[model samples]
Target: MTNATQAQLSRTAEFIAGAKATVPLIIGAIPFGIIFGTLAEPSGLSTAGALAMSLFVFAGSSQFIALGLLSAGAALPVIIATTFVVNLRHMLYAANLVPKVRHLPQKWRALMAFGLTDETFAAVSNRYLLQENIQNAHWFYLGSFLAMYGNWVLCTALGVGLGELFPDMTEWGLDFAMSVTFIGMVIPHLKSKPMWGAVIVAGAMAIATVTMPHKLGLIVAAVCGIAVGLSLQLLLKAQAASEAQSR
Candidate 1:
């Protein structure tokens, strides 16, 4: 086959592979979404409001935490600030996506940014980094994003309905699922020295900030992790280059 034909075939395969890889993430989002909707009602968020946040913000942990703060009568400014801090992990997300989606249009970048939740970002970033070529990344991302989006909206409605049937999620232990899911997603990625450094630093920082009010500690953890990871990666790269030159 011609080079052009082979390239087209490869791109097609990537799109399919990306879509298939997203199924597990979509399945995971289902329970998380239901929990968010159920808790949101008690937090004084209307059903419509909970659904809207799921559709718009689409951040699982951040949205749930924001609802908690709001229910506690946090000031509007404080709520906004805390939400921003909790979601600042998206900056690390964006950095990871730079190489994959850099060639896409500006408008596409904005959409991807909007859709960049923890689960989606994790899947796409992992694939992009490992494959090292993201020619069809937009299609790949869209498949995962729409799958997640559908499950979230549907599950949120289910949770809102079930909230009437079952009142206390704390007893059900649904809230802790997010933490477990995050750890599961992260552990496999810390195979290298740089990645391990990032994980350890982030974990330590998160523990240190556990006493911080309104979930600000998550922001600190993510920032520390990203900074340490990137710095270590750069240092390692430099060392390898120097060794090559010496030889």
Candidate 2:
């Protein structure tokens, strides 16, 4: 094969690998997406609006919170602010991946940024951590992003259809699958003291603030967890530096 053809094949293979890596997370998110769809109309969102949120916003937790607020007759500003706070965790995700993608062009960076969901981030970060096939890694990121984005949209549409047939479908509590999936993703990564510290602090904060309005507890937990993680990391680095200097 020619060089160009071989390069094309390599990109395709990387993309497929990325998508395959995200399959477990996608399975977990399916019921969550469906639940969002089932609850959307009952929570005062039109079918089009529901689909638009999945298409455009593409943030499951924020969408669910926004739906609840809409049903409660919340103001537009309130919905926007609440969801914005809930999604601030994405900033950290972006920060973690910025070093790896900084050399890419603006267009590529923008597209990747738009498609950066939790599942995609987890899959991409793990791939980057392994430092495997660095040249075509972006293709892998794209594959994971598209797989998750497509799956979410399809599941949402399915939920919308199911909602029409069974108006009470949201009451079945199928959303727990997502919680299990998140736990599975996070547990494997807690291989260090900083990670364990962050999880512990975040869990405590989440429980303590569970009764807060508009699900603000989630934001609080995320902030606390990030702070704890960063502090521990810095401290460890400083200790290592001091030890090296003494030696």
Candidate 3:
């Protein structure tokens, strides 16, 4: 085969490998996606609406917040703002990834941005950040992204269909199980002082604002946590620089 054809084949293989690697993580999210789907229609969204949200919006936390706000008859602007705030973390995720993906075409970056969930970030970090000498890393990211996107869409459709039969599935408290599972998945990644600080601050703020109206408290907590983490990181860096200068 020609060199170009061989390169193409290699990229395809890498993409498949990335998708396969993400299977476990995507499987973990099946329960969450189904629960979100089941809750969607009851939250005053149509089946089509739920599917569309999964397709376009695709952010689990923001989707839940939007559904809750919609159910509570929140104003459109408030719903938009709340969901935007909930998804603001993606900005940081993108910042960390930009240098790695800067060479890709705009189309690839755009689609990848849409797919950068916590799961994909974790998966890609292992590939690009934790390892050396990666080739066509974007293809791997694409594969993981497609796997997650497909899993969510298919699971949602199943949940909505089942929900039509069992209207009370929403009250079965399935979301709690998903929450526990999610926490387990995230705890292993808090391997640094900065991460621990962020988690503590965010958790505390979330608890303190649990009773806030329109779930605005989540936005407040997210901002507070980011602020605290950023400040702590800067302070530590300054201290290290001062010590180096003194030495």
Task: Note the Cα lDDT for every prediction shown.
Answer: 0.80, 0.92, 0.85
Candidate that scores best on lDDT: 2
lDDT of each residue in 1-247, candidate 2, tens digit only:
9999999999999999999999999999999999999998889899999999999999998999899899999999999999988888899899888988888999999999989888899888878866855788999999999999999999999999999999888888899999998998899889999999999999999999999976778878988998999899999999999999999
Regions more than 4 Å wrong, model 2: 238-247
Give the TM-scores of the predictions, in the order they appear. 0.86, 0.92, 0.83
Question: Which ten residues in a row are the worst by lDDT in model 1?
Answer: 169-178
Model 3, runs deviating above 4 Å: 212-216, 223-247
Name the 10 consecutive residues with the lowest summed lDDT in model 2. Answer: 126-135
State model 3's lDDT.
Answer: 0.85
- Superposed by TM-score, candidate 1 places the C-alpha of residue 207 at a distance from the truth, in angstroms, of 0.3
Query: Where does candidate 1 clash, by residue pair?
Result: none
Write out the backbone clash pairs for model 2.
Answer: none
Predicted structure 1: lDDT: 0.80
lDDT of candidate 3 over 30-50, digit per residue (tens): 878888888888899999999
lDDT of 2 at 165: 95
